[model samples]
Target: MTRSLPLLAALLALVATTPLHAEGDPESGQRVFNQCRACHVIENDGRNGVGPNLHGVVGRRAASIGTFRYSANMRELGEQGLVWTEDNLRAYLANPKAVVPRGSMAFPGLRNPAQVEDVIAFLKSRAG
Candidate 1:
């Protein structure tokens, strides 16, 4: 019993320290991504649209897609070593202008947090 208790405690500690998965639904995120289709593509071989192709974008350095022309601000951000982690994506999606004041992406923003989360989940799903 004493040995089991320590094992159980260690297991609990490991679980507690592990990052919790984001609660967004990837299926729902696909639906949400419909709104982004005019500009972005996530397929591995997808061509750049108004926005750059987003394959493997989840951890990619921002504005690094070679064929797409990025705004000076976007390029600057990338040069500064900004990787597109989930939290960074969330903030940028919530307010493009605020995140990169002169970025060329014209969309206003995703005002709904759930929608933002969903879109991010969709993007992450395609990141492989």
Candidate 2:
């Protein structure tokens, strides 16, 4: 029993330190995204509110929304062929400026890792 204790502790430590990726629930994410609706809309009709709609953002090319003008940095990313992938979305939600420096996405970023994951999941479901 004494020898097994140390091995079990080591395994627990390993699990604790592992990085978590977003495997968000679409419904949960939609609920959580309610906080975002005031500033942004997710429908695809090009409604032109304060922020751009997010309906098909996941796989859609960055800065490709014809009506909305994007920041220079975002345009560059699109030019560079940087499509929004799951991992990239996770990182961007964690810190948007870090992912697209000088871009205009002024969201403070979701503080909860799980929420970020959830949002990604929701977006993925709507993506083309």
Best candidate, TM-score-wise? 1
Q: Write one digit per residue (lDDT tens) for candidate 2, span 3-117.
A: 9999999999998987666367999999988977876778767475666688887877777877887888999998998887777877888899988989887787888888998
Model 1 CA deviation exceeding 4 Å by range = 1-22
Best by lDDT: 1
Clashing pairs in 2: none
TM-score of each: 0.81, 0.78
lDDT of 1: 0.89
What 10-residue stretch in candidate 2 is worst by lDDT? 43-52
lDDT of 1 at 33: 82
lDDT of each: 0.89, 0.82
